[model samples]
Target chain A: MAPKKLGLKQRYAHMTRGLDWETTYQPMDAVFPYDTFEGIKIKDWSAWEDPFRLTMDSYWKFQAEKERKLYAVLDAFAQNNGQTGVSDGRYINVVKLFLTGVSPLEYQAHRGFAFTGRHLRGAGPRIACQMQSLDELRHLQTQIHTISHYNKFFDGIGEFPHMHDRVWYLSVPKSFFDDARAAGPFEFMIAIGFAFEYLLTNLLFVPFMSGAAYNGDMSTVTFGFSAQSDESRHMTLGIEVIKFLLEQHPDNLPIVQKWVDKWFWRGFRVLGLVAMMMDYMLPKKVMSWKEAWEIYFTEAGGSLFQDLERYGLKVPKYADVATEAAEHISHQNWAVFYQYSHAAAFHTWMPDKEHLDWLSEKYPNTFDKYYRPRWEMWAEMEKEGKRFYNPSLPQLCQVCQIPMAYTEPGDPTKIAFRCTEVAGETYHFCSDGCKDIFDAEPEKYIQSWLPVHQIFQGNCGGATVPDVLNWYRMNVGADNMDYVGSPDDRLWSEWHAAKTREAV
Target chain B: MSVTAIVPDYARRIEPRDPVENFHGNMLVYVHWEDHLSFCSAVAFPLPPAIPFGAFVSEVVAPAYAAHPEAASIDWSAVVWMIDGATKVPDMEASLAANGMKHKTLVRFWTPGLSGWKGTAS
Candidate 1:
């Protein structure tokens, strides 16, 4: 007779719990050294629950099927000359930014999860992290493969790995993951799994995917959908870890709460890049960044915190500040990028009439009153063959590494600045949130590799524009600055002109 | 305390202290109180020479805090000026220029014993 097959739940239990054994030669603490250092009290490892009930066999099967489907779409996208199908060449900058900034983060997440998976004391979270590790790695690979098609037709796509490490703007995402990676296992989980993946991932991923769909980049949309299916599982793991730690001991609540506050603001600051991309970069806009923030964060996230209320957890410390910032952050960041696009790897442009009208509609309270006039000034300059680019580098905040561009909370008219003097030397922060993070761990942040500081110190390429661009491995005229007279722009116009001739 | 008198002198003192040698110009010197959590905002102004630290606090930081909704309760006289790490600049009569402060130099106004504020420094 054939061996009896296990049922689904039994199979999950056998695959997950059965993998663990009592270690006689080495104690559990010696074996798993990372889990307890974060001060999280876990009384029983068995109390951990993998909500997906996922096993290695099922995990591999599902991911493999998803990969096959994603690759098929990517192939068709390439075969059909999908680059030409995009709404406009300007849209490619969104892909370029995604490739250079966000994809490398996926690889970093993979490494972070793999380390945590191996070291976490609980078999439940370990398996979940391990599976999520593979998922992150898959996301990185699929994104690179999908966007590499654009690299052939685009300028800024080359040297992404190097750029992610060294570029000024890319530092936002790089430093964020590095901060999480340096934390204790539990803190790392809370930072990425909960604060980033569960609470804020939709705001980052959904808009980009929908923007991809709107811009006719089907490959990105396909890969995005494929990765999002796994994101649901990652989200479950995020909430589970938070609940597990909270249930373990009452002392764990405050620690978890602080991490929630710190990581939420950190993640929100990083998404300022995404917010600008959604509101400005897409030729055909999907949804306003403010609208997405209200739906995904204010509404959905508010409910999530409400669910956790019984566990004695409150919303993050600066939730209201972030809610208010959503209305203004995209406008503020895009303006900074517009002025300093010369130093960046990606292109920036003034939004056309239709785009400006949409922004005015979406941000009626502040757009016309505060932001529209600046764009109008730039647009006026462009009309006379003059584009304004700030020749000097702006001051960078110590913690977030962004240019000091944010305004005071509840007051968009004044630039908000926060500073703390520690041990004699003063550090500047973009907001109270960043200032608080630095004050808590000054030693960690004082070592930030700020690009502007690095350049001034003669660490980046050299002192001049040519030297720095070469050092950043950027193509200068081809890869960066205003999109109006760019090679991509010229190519776009010529392609359309040829199409018009063909139709005649 | 004339605005024009302070402007040119502050520019002269602060412009040369930029850590980046290539960066030369008037830059903002940001000061904040360490003990008062409500006093987190950096009161930025051009650096001026020969201004007493006490006057700087009373005139600059105090008014800024007074404007803030939550910071009205902070005691201005009790705060100490901290600069360059652990060094305490005890002479409030000394000018910022005499004490060697520069543009973007962070001066933290700290109180010795403030209850309810979480102190991270050991």
Candidate 2:
């Protein structure tokens, strides 16, 4: 006969705390050598609380059910030829950026969580991280499986893992993860769990998922929903980690605050790529990046910092600068990509007149004044049969690795530049925030694998454009440069034409 | 020969001739240092062309220990300069124009012990 069924709280407590123990043979520090080195003083390990109170049994069962639903949708999407269902061929580039840039980051998250799970001193956070680790791995797998459907029909999606590792632009996300992973365990939690998942995730995830929904990419939407459902729990974990640290000891506040500042800016700079994707790449625009930032960061994040203010915690430094930048970064980044698309692993095209009008409406203050004129010049160039590309590579920031194209704060005329002198050498940053991060840890950033510098150093493929593209595993005409007269464009036209004929 | 004699034609074209107006007012130069294992950092300074390149290297770049702590241990007198990826600016009293330097030009500083210089494509 089976034993009496246990209640939810009892089961969760038993499942999570059952394995933890008081050390008899060895000291706790001896057993967990990795956690305390970062100087985060934990007064009581049992005081650590898991907000979800998730048991492994319930976790596996719930996750399995979600997987079943997601797999059913994935199978249906592939079986029904879902690639054709997207709004336009340009919509696929969004998926390309997601697959190449964002998906691998999930895998990195998986590894990072697993590392923290094993090393953290407390059983509470360890179990939470382990669950999130599995969740990240699942997200990575589902994202790949979903986008692999497009790989069979597209060019750029084929070699994403390789491209993520070696390509120039992909380094932004890669280096962000690498920086987090290289930090100490507590710093890792603050970096990934708190700063990334809690503070800035909505800005990253909501736009893509909503864009997927609007563009009729049902498979992506399903996967996004699945991952995002887990993200809620991760968000709780992020909040819990911050609160746990701040409440533990007074010393933890300053340390946690620094991580918040550094990771917030790092996360913000990385989201510049996403901002550009949201504004420019989507065939059917959801909301402007400015709208998303104002809603997610300004409103929600404002309330969050207010809540934390009682604990002597404050909002991230440079947050106002980031708010000011929301108007221009998307446009600036997209313009850069439009001019340099030949060097990238995805296609770019001039925003049509309607899209430009939408942009002007969305960004009334800055779009028409600064960015519109540049796009109009490019349009005239295209009309004159001279599609322009920047022959020379722009100088990249040593810390963030983005090209030094960011304009001065409040004034978009001059480039914003910040530099610091360390040990008789100079390091340049895109902004004061990035420069501050570099200054705080000169040794860490001094080892950055800047792609432009690597290319100049003869480390990337070879010396020429063809060689670099080959090294990046990109097909020249099919994958790189303008999408106007390419194979994807031709196929899209043919498919639409056939649809019209069939309707007739 | 001084760095001016060996300055590349492309760099020379961009170098400012008017020292007082250009360098003192608005001209900026970006300097970078790299070692064999990819140790690097770039610093930007609004420098006057009237100041000698050697003085800039010694007074400005050498004392910039805060940006690059690794450089503090190294001897600044031993470092060499690569201007705009081509001309090797020697340790002498050459003006910004004399070294073919202009606003926003990148100057790379390295030591003899570092790895061989990999030429940058124009």
Candidate 3:
């Protein structure tokens, strides 16, 4: 008989673990320079245990099949003019925000994991990261294809990659991934692989995908399903990498803990956009941002930390502050967008009376108490032929780079302000979490490219708003400002009216 | 504290990206009208340090808040002035530099009775 076909486990073991070799021409340290410099002493490369075994042959085949299925559905979505099927015109702004603010981040993750795949010493994790890197690249491609249909109709999405590099709000997500990509191999793994992928991925992707489902965007939900398989491998690798690093040496715990804490807060700040999207942008609601945070972070991440407690890792620092923030950040972010909508690539509007009542229902304690007045004021101003737009730029935090819009934890009335004097210069922060992050790494934060600072410095093309918008590649009135008289609103309304006429 | 990096030494010294000198003789002064959340956060203006404090108030700070309904009625004498969280009383005729307001200095002012829109404090 032919030699017994190698079983799946044997093949995976041979294909992956059997690939490493001792170097004689160059020392192992020379070959693997990146893994050691991070101060993480890996005692044994062989000791790493992969939670899932996926060889290149199988990874390609599996991913290729998913891509085929995903493309087929996306093709149908485009052919069928699926944009008209969405809940309302306002819903497209959520997609615009994602395409502009988020899709580029997938590409950044791809680059990050590609760098990580080459740098890690262990063959098991190297193969794992390489596969995840390809998965990220594929995810980017699929996300572009998934949302490309919107670009044909939407104003803001036409220059997503351009905007991702330069837009003020897009910088929030861009700088986040840039921070991870610029970190050491070990820190990159912990910051992105563990904290972002395992702990926070559900919180980020679920809102968009579920929002797609609830609002009748089939292609978005379809790609979400396609990417789910790859995400599983990534999540597993995330946990495994954390476990491996922690178990490698006792010294690794503090370093890993700091990365976890830093990335968690950084990721929390970035997710404020998502909070706004779920709360205000989605015409048909899913769970409230507070409710989603409770389920995903409070309940799920609570268990994850409890499990990680065995390795002397407690929950990330300031998790309670982050939890409390979920109640208010959405409103604060929405308000920021509302006043400064003239500068944003997407449209902004005060919610209608019914929508305001929905907000009061969702955020009973805070809505009527703290946030409604601003919305009502803006609405009333619009009625008086004076739609209010903040003429001046707002101050941005040095660490997370969000506008300093967040209020003090206990006091919803005042914007939380924290600052530190580093060297001869002063840096500002939105909260204690960002302050701690800056204090820990003052050298890194002072180099923040705060958009307002850039504009005032005359570096972002010019001194005037029109000049800056030109440099940002913004289409002026077409792309930026309120939704009421926009081309998108007009088209959506025309289509809506035609459908009504046909029904008649 | 320095950046944690594998290559800590670059070819040249690391410089802060937003030093005051980069702004062409102007400093970014952050002004917050306490309890006013409609502007969302403190707004910053690039102004010359030699500009008169009165001009900085009348030209830059006052107009930024002119959109507020109660703006035309506020008592400038009773407005509490704090710079970087410390209460200060500076001469209106003096320069911002003489008033000790430097680059990135946050100037917080409170209008005694006017809290926010309808006292929602937003």
Candidate 4:
């Protein structure tokens, strides 16, 4: 039977509980105001078209289903010897980073989405934003829940909340959120909605999901992809938000232009970790960071730039810097990851031969020349049962909180450095400008959320890896013992054994 | 919050060549709105003759575009749709290209009084 097509009011009622109180009786009294600012007149706001065919019923049902599926997986993983299934205790570093760096962004998205839900004008849009808000809230919860499973087994997860509050390394994401939260509603849409969602979302989620898949982490991939489905809707919201504002006011152009320029660079800097994870961390590499950026940013961005130029706005400054960063970010960040693993919750295993082969294929220019040799040295150490761990703390960037993986533009080897004095003690930074920024505001600088500092202060996990792992809820696996009898391995063996017995 | 590539096994390199002789630059622009009374961001990409802006936008951009708008107008067939960037879209280039839209003659304008400028007139 063909589905009955109801009128807009009836359909809306079927979708939502019912139309607003006055829909049937009250006469339309210009309840919704049109855009009057800047003197751009729209004779018809009704001309607007909603691309997403979302209704309340479908929204709730799909969301509920997604939750059911996710929890089932989580339950299985935990119940069937999931506790000991890991690559190594070293791999917890990735989760540590995920909890501290990535998970907090989930919370930020939740907050931002809530703001969008409340502020959006039309009912249809309000619904979309509300769905997105719920989606982001779920994402935050699931990411915490899934990774929390590891808190019992790893070190760095315990430090995330405290680190997010006070770690210098965490300030990268924190400041990014702070910038968004401080902006006007429209500006927030541009900064995060358009700039981050449209321009940068692919960079953030792709590598993390692929890394999860490659490392046999089913939960992260499921949750990441599940959340991303909603992100597609959010991306549309971003795109529409920009168009709607521009169409509404001719005066908004320059303000919008500056926002694009500023946010593009800001979001790009924060995504440096993503750049590394894309190019370096995944065991089964799909695309290089440079390639993803070029395809996602350049081909797509170049077209958008031309379109905007027709409208009259400059392509963002530091765009060239972003393109350049993509080229070397993988090698640089992995090096930092290798050095910092001693302090991190995750393990850092030397790149296996298969991983090296993938690197050679992905990074045709630099991997073999510079990073490959370094990995080879680590491989040799691994051969002798030694894992290389950098003894000293890395110089962290003041702005991004990441250890400065940057060198002079084009000089990959020259590490950047800066320093400042606060409370009669010299503080160090990745660049002189950062040092200057710190010196100009020592109070803000001193209040930084540095994970390493907290670790030493005995505020996290009672001064031991196990204690910290418990706090973080991490679980080390069979891979930790060279892939022999960890949960994954045991489960594999058990499943196979059962199958073999059935065969008999 | 999270971005997943829905397309299957899609991968390519972003190779930037040094300035080459006889390079004819073409551009693609896409303007999309996220929600009602929210904001519209434009994405622009500079393409050589090699890339077909229309196909990319229809196949890749439209789905993403539809996802964002409370009410979105999707013109997969309209390759060179001119968006008045000054008035309707801001930072119009990157957002368009991010969604796979493009144009031939790219101009950036910001004032509402400016006549014949597709964006806001200055």
Candidate 5:
């Protein structure tokens, strides 16, 4: 027999160490040019510690096992016709949003991490990013495979990838990922890895996974479980990168703080979609958006920042604004969806009496006062055969790309609108947080592709609504309208009726 | 606080994505019906700067807000109109350009008695 196999720690060291070598053909400065431009100082590359220890040898072996488990569940789901098990047809809209809006972001993360892994000089962090890049690719593939079963039985799942690129509301998440990917390597890590993956991923993932479990969707819940282990590794890498940068040099503290502030605000702005799903889309609710925000961001993030206080890193700016917004954003976002239902890929409808009362109970202070009456009025209009869809396109915020629907922080009754003249032209933002972000980097955000502006400029399609609808590839009257009379609704009703008769 | 360049010696002077001239003889203007959160946000319109303000209000803006229950009760002439937050009474017959409404101008109009449905700001 050969020599005894090496211990786990020894094997990890042997595989990771001695991997980075000096460039003989080119200078070290030219090879690792991206790391220094962000003003971060790293005295020693070896000081970078691995948050999780797995070389490519083990990485492939470990991931293949996860793939096997994920696919087995997916096959089982399809064999049993798992689409019929959901709580309601409305719940399919939630999955439709995720497939179109979020899965493409995973693709973006894959590309970002590949760029990051290649550019970073340190072998330790390089290997870390490489593993994460692969994880992201796997996440995107598994998500598509998991949601594809629903595609066979749903109205809105056919055009997910196309919709992600062209849809107006989707620009919110697209722009966010695009901004991060275009930044320097260190900033991408902080923006996506630290701020998004670590800071805010829970708020996004919890509703989808737990909502899937609560609503009896076996395929999606299995996908969530498959991705859970990789997610922990990503969160660990996020913390390690922050600690590595802060510990590397004293000059890095302020730069890291600025990035933390910017991405935290950006992440909060994009989570409004998830907030709406949690509050309105789920037929069987996991929790209210406010409760999820309290648990994920307020309570958990508080102690996290407190831990970082010794490193001279305070909480992100606009934390107070975000806290106040957790209560109102879901309601505001649902109103936007309700009024613009004609333009969306998925169907939209006003909540029923049971749902409205649940929202009122969950959001006692502001729901009845600010939101319930609007729902009641819209519901009444629906009953009277006069469904209200906003005829005009909405004014979008330049930075966030969401419509300017958010109200003032202090006064909920008045809409908050902020604008500034950048280079003698005006740019509008929904809040001071976004305005400040733009003020810092107007050169970057000023080039934002606001979809409404594009549609107005004749870049989308032709002059008519049908022209734009054709460009979006949305099957109007079936894919983009009230759910009550749509094809999906009728099919779901027929299936349940047949099942009821069989039971009798 | 500017964005740090990814590569050294990169150009910094950037152009706005959607500028004034891109709209093809039309200008982008936002109309906010101040207290009506039911419309959800200020509605954006691509209007010719030469369009008369009076006709723009009734032809374009009124149709947008016509579905609201209070739309019928509002006195259009008595509404308080503010252009870009500076209160100004516009000449309804005058063109948008003559009324000082330029690109990205936010025209917020407040109905004297109707804040929102039942004053709930709905």
Candidate 6:
């Protein structure tokens, strides 16, 4: 009898291709140098194999289909007057937070992917990189298109480009990439592909999707899911690249190991913002940061590190640090966000009863002991008709540009501060190395377009919240408020009355 | 091409002075791989030397290639990993051999700021 073949391969083959394929929407260009630079010798570019095989035709077809599905849901929600029906208007602040902080990141991904497609030597790797490049661009575009709908009803969505440039908070992302751009090619792979995509992406993207689902922001959920499906392929490529390098040469191990160590910490440090967003900012919270980090990083990448241990590579130097930080960052970072809400893109009211209860239940060790009292104190101020704002400017970390939320390694409460003198002026930072970076090249960091300084200097729209909100494209309680019986309230009442009559 | 015939880009008028390349890209190297955690770390700290060139590729240059997927299939030769600073490993040649690695040549260069780890040849 002839050998019987299983249906799995045939089934996958049938389902994987044809009209379902989504490829690049943009054209290609020779952006990086191949023969021009003289340092590296290339014998065979084909050795660079991309584990994720993506083509242009398939890329467009699938991507367009996904977008069509998204817009359909968005349109349905809009046509049904979903804005008025939203259970809580305050939840929109989370989306607003996402728009300013996470939205621009899509564009940054687009830029990086495009670079990979052009400069990488191997056809397979290049094509894979190219496809991801397009995927990120689509992500950026779709995110903008989807979020713009909310702009019609909210505020602060318009300030993203300016916020990205001028906001001190934005430096967390800008400087991270700046460091990578200054390195070599192999480092790029380890930093981005291995350290970031393979290890940390699940922790980042999953919370975003869950947050969207919890908050009923269908557009964000849809886009995040669609984008993450592609991330699995990117993650595969990352694993392949690291494995290939480690297996290829012994010297490569130490070099690659060092990169793994550096980038793991670099990537972990950036997650502080995400930790804050997930645990505090999202009104309808899902899992805590500690839970997500342990599953994604400690389990998946940690196992991979065990595999690499035979090849003489240490688990990322910061693995334990990241785990410990993840355990407690939620309360620390959110406290910072709560105090600074007036200056941020989103609004920060006290965590409602349910949210407070959730925190108390989820974080028993530190919530009641430390953070809850702080919010209660703020609530007292609110009762007195006063809002709490940190009047003193936060001393920015020279490297991360964050208001030094990171504490002494194990102790989460003690603030870490480092200082350096440059050009006869003493500058302060949160870490020793950051101060060194500033001191070594004062010219670079001196020109950082800090947001708080910009706002105080009147470079932003105006001095007042209402003025700035308008400039930020926010259409909230100010322009679209309903204190008693305003237009939105009257319209909402009529809609509800008709619904009640229909029910009768 | 003769050594003198090649007017090197970095060190003006160098003739075969042990060529070493760093794959650190420009413009969009650190842009992709957009996990906020990674992005923050890149900004806030001195990145470990694991993939010294990751920032170059991830943020500076990867995006251009991302813009053009159709042209991904191309070929090249020879892989060289450059370590500009210091290492605990003694005997660079033996280390290279043990690691199953080979380079056209190994050039040791001194870079300040990498204090404790600076290479012995410097």
Candidate 4, residues A83-199, lDDT tens digits: the string is 445443334445657788878877887787677555544555556567767777788898988888877654446556655655434667887777566444556778888898887
Error at A105, model 5, angstroms: 0.6
Against the native complex, each candidate's DockQ, computed on alpha carbons, is 0.04, 0.03, 0.73, 0.01, 0.79, 0.01
DockQ of candidate model 6: 0.01
**What is the fnat score of candidate 6?**
0.00
lDDT of 2 by residue, A1-504 (tens): 998998888878888888788787998778888787677899987888886688888899999999999999999998988888799998998999999999999999999999999898789999999999999999999999889999887779989999999998899999999999988888999999999999999999999999999999999999998887799999999999999999999999988999899999999999998899899999899999999999999999999999999889999999999999999899878877876788887889999999999999999998886677667766876788767665445567877888777767997654566776554445567899898888776656767787765665567788687888899988888998888887888888888898899999
Which digits, one per residue and each the tens of the lDDT, describe model 3 over residues A144-230? Answer: 888888988889888889988888888899889988887888899998899999999988999999999999999999989999988
lDDT of 5 by residue, A1-504 (tens): 898998998889888865668899999889887878888889988999898799898899999999999899999989988898889998999999999999999999999999999999999999999999999999999999999889888898899888888889999999999999989999999999999999999999988999999999989999899999999999999999999999989999999999999999999999999999999999999999999999999999999999999899989999999999887999999899989998898988889999999999999999999899999888888889888889899999999999999999978888899998876788899999999989988888888999899998899887777888889899888889888899999989998998999999
Task: Rank all candidate structures by their DockQ, best first, as comma-separated numbers.
Answer: 5, 3, 1, 2, 6, 4
Deviation from native of the Cα of residue A58 in model 3, angstroms: 0.9
**Pick by lDDT: which candidate is best?**
5
Error in Å for residue A363 of model 2: 1.0
lDDT tens readout by residue for model 6, A1-504: 998874754443343332232235642223344322323344444465547654465667887887888788778877876665543556566666667776676666667666765665555566776777777778778778777887776666766776665555666776676665444555566777777788888877788778778777777777776677678888987887777776666766766776677677767767777787777767667787877787888888778878878878888765776776676677666666665554565655577678888888877776675556556655665668655554333445655567655555665434454655443333446554355445544544555444443444456587565565455554555323221233334554676788799999
Candidate 3's C-alpha runs over 4 A off are: B8-12
What share of the reference contacts is kept in model 2? 0.00
CAPRI tier for the interface of model 6: incorrect
Task: Provide C-alpha RMSD values for all models, in order.
Answer: 11.6, 12.6, 1.2, 21.6, 1.2, 18.0
Write model 5 residue lDDT over B52-111, tens digit each, in one string.
999998999889899998999989989999998799999989999999999999999999
In candidate 3 chain A, what residue range of length 10 has the lowest lDDT sum?
A440-449
Better of 1 and 6 by lDDT: 1
What local lDDT score does residue A365 receive in model 2, on the 0 to 100 scale?
93
Kindly list the per-residue Cα lDDT of model 1 for residues B15-87, writing each as its tens digit.
Answer: 2112424343433455655433222233445435567777877776666544322345566566667674445
In lDDT terms, how accurate is model 3? Answer: 0.89
- Candidate 2's displacement at residue A162, Å, is 0.5
